[model samples]
Target: DVEKELEVQIGMKQEMELAMQMLEKDICDKQDVLVTFRQQLDDVQSLNHELSQKVQGSDNVIRQKNEIIARLEEKASQMNCTIKQLEQRLRQTQSSCQSAEEANYLFKQEFGEKILRLQNEVDLLTKQRSQLEMGLKDKKLSLHSDPHRINGSEQVKADQQQMADMKKELEQLREENLRLRQAGEESPSNGIHQSSRSSAEAEKERSTLERQNVICKLCEEEVSVTRLKRRCHNCQAIFCSQCAINELPLPSSIQPVCVCNPCHRVLLQQYSTTPPP
Candidate 1:
């Protein structure tokens, strides 16, 4: 009986040991599941943070695009205004040109005979001037090659006197050209006269636009625009008014326009050579 009791106690002890072992294995399994759940939660939080950063970056790009759009709209508005102003000026210029053309036709009809006679004289003078220039050049080259030619001093004096005479003739022609144009310019043609006056004033004002110091091509004088420098209509060269004092009619316009003296001279020669219409 004591041995039976001992066996039963031993069986009970073995059953308790088995139950303890099962409980420990179950606890380990529960711990592993909890650790897996914690890892999943951390991964979800990281993904949410990444999505927030991407959203903020997208907002910045959208804002920049809006600013660019506003600037473009403003620039387009300014350009439209500029185009409108240019169109207005074009219309005014066309109207002024038409009035000048009518006046020019009247002047041509009135002075046709006188102009022909004057033009014939101009032709004779220009031919003489050309011959004189050629002769002077030939003499200069000869003197340079052979220093022993007749005293350069005497020859030079005669040449200078001849040049002076030619210069006088040229000046007369220049004066005649100006007088002819002025007659047309001063004609009491309503819009034409006013347009000519305004054009001259505008030319003077426009010439003063350059801010930086510029040297006059003819005089080589440093000029501050407000006082003197002007552009020649014929040559498109800048010079002091003193050097470009002559006024002549441009081929395209009937009104007398400012031109450099050299250009005025050349223009006279060319006009003299051309046959009258």
Candidate 2:
């Protein structure tokens, strides 16, 4: 009976040990699973951060687009007002000239020039109206071309965001070009064009001048375009890169500065102003 009792106790101990081993293994498995879950959570958080940045960028683009649209609408209204005023002026001028023979003779003499100017103004207004119409059309086309409408509903926002960014950039470029044109018309001095020299000698001279016109040797920023980018470091007044370089101290090892015909006198004045050591 004692032997049987001893045998039963031994069997119980073995079963308990086996249960303990199984419990230990289960705990280890749970720990491994927890570690994997932590890693996955970290990855998900990082992805969320990136997605947030993209979302913010998209929002900024949308805001810029709305601003551009508002500006375009304002410009359109102004053009319409100008057109009405011009038409009134033309009618009044025509009526005044019709009654007097002397006025009519002078009007006839000036009619060709006056008519040309009026036609030019009308054509400009028509073009401005057409541009606004096209911009509106582009916006509509972009809105409708969203591929997301065919797919899942979630992508619609992203597509709209992308289209808005593109339109904003286009509007900015157009506005800049318009401002440049207006500035050119107002100030003839601001209008500068690169002369296309055909001859090799002229091309060489042009190339030399072009190289000198760069603001910084390292960045290769053009002095002419530099005015639009930023003010000159030396004069605080904006000049093309070539103009800036011309003001730089010439190295004994390097050649003399290449300047445009107009800038030559300025360069001479600058040289004369330098006090001798």
Tell me the number of clashing residue pairs for each predicted model: 0, 7
Top lDDT model = 1
Over 169-266, each residue of candidate 1 has an lDDT whose tens digit, in order, gives: 86787677667766766774334432345767776666553454678897587776433777898878888755676666676555667888678667
Which residue pairs in candidate 2 have backbone atoms (N, alpha carbon, C) closer than 3 angstroms, thus clashing? 212-242, 213-241, 213-242, 215-241, 223-240, 223-241, 224-240
Stretches of candidate 1 exceeding 4 Å from the true structure: 1-27, 113-181, 187-277
TM-score (all chains, Cα) for each model: 0.41, 0.35
Tens-digit per-residue lDDT, 83-185, candidate 2: 9999999897655544332432333243324333333343344345445555656655665776445443334445455546655654555454344334323
lDDT of every model, 2 decimals: 0.71, 0.50
lDDT of 1 at 72: 93
